[model samples]
Target: MINDLPIRKIIHVDMDAFYASVAQMDNPDLKGKPIAVGGGGTRGVVSAASYEARKFGVKSAMSGRLAIKLCPELIFVKTDFERYTEISKRIRNIFFDYTELVEPLSLDEAYLDVTENKLGFPSASLIAEEIRQRIFREVGLTASAGISINKFIAKVACDYNKPNGQHTVNPEDVLQFLADLDIRKFYGVGKVTAEKMYLKGIFTGKDLKAKSLDYLEDHFGKSGSYYYHVVRGIHNSEVRPNRIRKSLAAERTFNENLSSEIFMLEKLEHIAEEVSKRLHKNNVSGKTITLKIKYSDFTLQTRSKTLAYFVRDKAIILETAKDLLYQNTLNNSVRLLGISMSNLNTKPQKTEPLKENTVSVQLQFKF
Candidate 1:
């Protein structure tokens, strides 16, 4: 329990086209062009696409075929998960220099709590600028930052000015900014919920605030309480450091159906390599390997394998995933393939004692 609340300072940092930008940075020819990284075959899925591709209605998660159809000249490159994961670590190290209260949402997005920074800085925006400069200089990637009183506002502010931009939302301005915001802009409201709100005449935060909590509860159930508080600029989620991940998985939905087993194996290898890289970076190992396949008709099936000991080796991961894939021979042509590792040993020990055949144990997992 922490008392004596000081002025809250939070910042959200998001990389612009993180995956695609990394690809573009490495290959100058890709710059300013419609480029995507992921599976390349007709059955390949896009892991990330540049903003230029987005202009042509190309988006991540759209089947690779649909993306190419939307942008005839779209360039598809294989994903380099190893490279992106390395850069993510470098950026994270930069965050630790100012404050340890960092919560990474993914490789490209994170929230920093700098209410009490080591540098004794008074303004969070200054710290944000320095971090952005460091990322560009050190990692060779551009990052946009948002500074605010809390995570929610900061995240929204970051998106407001994207592609290497920064914005700060003060406590005093929270209400005005949120007032005109569409109800859909609220974090938890999805397309379905937004449509529901629209039908109920809830167009903006002001309209949302007019409804009673009981009324919202009747419609949205438990999440309604969250909507009520968020509209009033009241959120209480703390920034935690080094949070452990329970599972790591990567999946791709191809643009076209794939009948060739060899092509599907190549895609799985890529996903497996990425999942393994993430596991190794976190110093975590998994005992379970899961392989998922989706057919042209959208039917999905999953297979899993459990190991006796935790492992993080990429070769082992790929081998296990390959075995799982072979076990579940596809009845229908595969449209999507995914490799995931879970049931991880949340705690990892660096050194193993040779005292006994069973080997000594060390508590390395940090909560």
Candidate 2:
């Protein structure tokens, strides 16, 4: 077992079906009925699905047509970002009551480092319980929490008892807890990565923990070390209240300006690759793709497209960048080409760990 485990008490707080719940709370008529926010038309995609809708196979990102087919009575409600933002602020203010180390991953979820809290409480589980209780009473919504020694473990645990529940993993139980976890449930494994791991006979945390770091590196490349460490519950990332990125970009200035569409596409492919790597490294996705073109004469032009959903994959980013490139003809030979992504999903949910000296936490936990 890892020695002298970090004393930090981390709690992950996730609102239950946030958008759908807010819709229901705002419109009592929608309560207890299957409803979906967004994706109202044939070509639309759902942004959020209520718990009732989820039971019928409706989910966020599913086509509206399919959601209707699964639950014919499903009601569609337009998304109200202003209202969502309003409620998110209320929830965040509640968090500040306990600790300032709050890292918001999205409007619906956040990570809190309550190692030393305003309440002078040593038991993170108790703090989580009180926080959830407060959210319900003060905000008229439910929140789930997972309390543990670090961010990743807390993130995974919070999902265990979802929709108005919580789970706590003590320091001593961290390793075994990870060992028994399904690889698919591991954060950041994603669908494509999970399929690759399955093909390699890496189906669970135990299976992944058996693979050498070099083996993971050979297969997963940039993401290999992430898999190697998380399986051991080694995430040491600290919460940053202001950790955010407004935009991410990658650019290239040609040694020689070229006017050919083929050459521009080649340069765009490379730029997209770099942007995609940065997106993955930061654990973020973006809905807006912008292509910046600099003419040989130094005049600048930018074309942008904003999608309805977030994208982080290289192929999709490249395709969007290509579409923007073709949207207009070259006014002049391009001296510099750049690709940037904005309107990102939110904060970085996962990151590599850092080393620290041995620190101790209180023994008694009021779970």
Candidate 3:
């Protein structure tokens, strides 16, 4: 069956320390220094850290306070989405020069289907190399590329040689490559899922392939089927261009934990307002509202409720969020709060109801 499938030339391109690298590129003074792009306050989270800062253990999504503790000389810069967005557009233009089938995962990374490219390039490796070189020459930022027969392997390969590097997995090497991969590194297997897989004696692709499809399904639900196929080097998901935005969210971590319900409600109002603005900007409305709460200890909880009709108004969003919040007991002092809207689009797709306590997981394509 594997031999029967047509081999695709997929390339996943990822920017090296995108935001941090952009900062350094635009300002020569910041080059070769430890810098983090985000607020410097104790409650702030690092959006991106330069490779120099990473050497000292600083990372994205980490608290600024902890990042400072790890790298005392770390420099913090506020995020400039406008600049990044413009740069991303230029990179996408570079991709379009090769193939029209480009799927952007974020401002910094994308997947390109170059089986038949406009440039008439026969070697995917050469195309990837040329793309990386062009990005460096034109955009003044380095990018890494991964070439393979499918999105899953291509994305995984991109990470193998990161920070201005490229890696390729030929069709013939796909199975062997997957066999040696750590389960933790597999797409869609998060920390919780990996721990579960470990306890079930599935530590690598080889171990995962040993499990029966029925067994995997029984243990991991719908996602088990995904695992079963992906382990066999059978990912068939395509590179969908211009995929619609499924959700819009806004979140913030307070400098001091908020214990009072009134304060939490006030924060929710602000978050809902931001979400509403984003929804309006996108010209979309959603039927479901989700409120995310993070405790001071870092334990997380989410509550969601789907409405009968789609809404994009700040009043509606704030009211729905308040209901979701008040219904749940605030068992811990909340350190972070967030709200998101999903089930977007007026014409809804007939789908199964989202399971309780389950957050929609975006497939791990973007690093």
Once superposed on the true structure, which residue ranges of model 1 sit more than 4 Å away at CA? Answer: 1-4, 250-293, 301-334, 337-367
Q: Give per-residue CA lDDT, model 1, range 241-289, as digits (tens).
A: 7666888888877767898888888898888888888887778888999
| Clashing residue pairs for model 3 | none
lDDT of each: 0.83, 0.89, 0.89
**Residue lDDT tens for model 2, 231-281:** 776776788888879899998767678798898888888999999999999
Q: How far is candidate 2 from the true structure (C-alpha RMSD, Å)?
A: 10.9
User: Can you give the lDDT of residue 169 in candidate 1?
Assistant: 72
In candidate 2, position 255 carries an lDDT of: 68
Model 3, global lDDT: 0.89
- When summed lDDT is taken over every stretch of 10 residues in candidate 2, the lowest stretch is 357-366
**Which ten contiguous residues of candidate 3 have the minimum total lDDT?**
355-364
